[model samples]
Target: EAATATATAAAGDDGGGAWRVVGGDASADGGESPTRGDASRLSRAVDVWSLGCVLYGVLDADEHPYGSWFEREVNVINGKRNLDRIKHLPEAHALITALIEEAPTARPSAVEALEHPFFWPDARRLQFIQEVSDRLDKITVDNPMLDSLEGRSSAVFGHRGWQVVLKPSLLEDAGKHRYYRPHSVRDLLRLIRNKRHHYRELAKPLQLELGDNAGAFYRYFAHPSRFPGLLMAVYAFATEYLAHEPLFAGYLGPETARRYAADAKERCASAGASEEDMLAAEEAARAAALLSGDTLQETRREWFPREDAWGDAARFSVSSAAAAREAAGALGSAAGLPPVGGPAGAAAA
Candidate 1:
């Protein structure tokens, strides 16, 4: 029970905390049989089984396929459980089951689990897994826009022309020892000035169509706003539909990027904002977004970081598994394993 005691001590308080290292536990089942090497391997197999369970939980957003952990473990030990309940359990469940065999000697080693077809999959899954495994180099940026100079800076820049930059502290990573150089206000504004032409084109249409509804979007971007409903709508739709699109990563979704772009066309037709104004707002958001500081902040924030109106970013952010599949359908291949899908029609427009 020494390993069990150590693991129990290592578990510390059961109160969930910000950091946790999900790993294997030794010394369970009364520390019976096997040498240190065999015990370590057996311990890892238990950890893998636990991980398979946790992976299912996370994939299901905390829902357990067998109802509860206690119940699931009981059922599993009773030989009354099957792993197929996990939405996309993959064939790896078989390999994991083999690893978790009741008899210590029967359990597969971690090395064996790693080599299983479930882990390796076919070429596509292999490519995606390798990409995700190597995603440390991928950059996703999210940002909030700063308050515009109103009409004053507008005169300095242009009616539609604008610039944006992020504060540098946002780029700092607690995990990294090296510090990031913060961008100066001058650097941000200047970049905005230089990129203004490119962005104004995107804002033009939105500025015209939604009129006042459009102002809220820009205001939210300029500074973090307490109210971000409209902006969130825009960000969600865009990220879902366009995250993979190269030009649009850091840039907020174009007003036209909505899952139902036609709905926007209808809105514009009803509002009667001239095409010019709509174009102005859309381009303004895009241009400023391109030049926005939050973009850089978000870029540093996640593996797939994209600034939402709420200002949160994440890599491997939780998403509707079905939506991921639809996205895969749209993109021609699932980025990795079919993400655990949310409820049906979860990713639909």
Candidate 2:
């Protein structure tokens, strides 16, 4: 996944070769580059704008708002204020323009990005975003994809183009139109339906955030061990250290935490470990870590996914050898010391 992400980024950069070049003629006939003329150094800003275009393209399946190529150029020249050009904007189109502004200084910083009007208008609106968040959560895999397909299969294939490998079937169908491998009508229907289904499954449960500019959470997920592993590590820490009640409420939510605590308690009962035993285990581990000369707690802290992102260092109590192994494995590492081997063993050390 990491390799794929790096390759994709490189592809993105390379495909926009005219973007990197300093000068050309913006006013000239049919120059592909946006920064061809005056303010060419401001091309970096065009990259930001193209990023917005790419985001919209993915979200809406590569439909340009402008009706035609000429219309697109006109809108770009007028800074895209023409309502006819963007009549279908679902949210603030101004925000998109803000990020894609031809002027570099007009763009927002990474940190200030989260607070953009495009995110939510005000604190109250932001709080209301929980509603948008919920509705977004409810947006199934089918909705967007189903909406994107408007019986335009032939046009889609024409636009995207198709490739076929040289194969025995081609030789067998030689001199016939079948040799060229045009998709059957049934094939096109099946292809569109399958794509819609695939994208629907792909987009569910995702969240988007704005930073330095804006991108979706799924973008980070595309990179290996970048965000999901970090999230899991934090979740593991919350379970290991904090009392179940407070830990659940603080990390997840009050309602969720309470439900989980009840679940955990039930699991404890089923396992024959009394509440007293659990408390005793926690207390003993905390004490042993504090009294010992070694920074056992810091060793555990290294398991956190985004430990480097946290400003302050935090610690975990040294557990039994088995418990330590469990912790290590949960954070996607191998178990090291045994839980009952020796003085260093986790057996309630």
Per-residue error (Å), model 1, residue 96: 3.9
Q: Write the per-residue lDDT of candidate 2 for residues 15-113, one digit (tens) a residue.
A: 434332212223222335443443443444455555555544444553643324445544554444332334233233544545544444555433333
* Candidate number of the best lDDT: 2
lDDT of 1 by residue, 228-262 (tens): 12222223333333333333332423332333345
On the 0 to 100 scale, the lDDT of residue 90 in model 2 is: 25
User: Per-residue lDDT for 157 in model 2?
Assistant: 37
Q: How many Å off is the CA of 199 in candidate 2?
A: 38
The parts of candidate 2 lying over 4 Å away from their true place are: 1-41, 65-67, 78-92, 117-349
RMSD over all Cα atoms, model 1: 24.2
Span of ten consecutive residues with least summed lDDT in model 2: 205-214
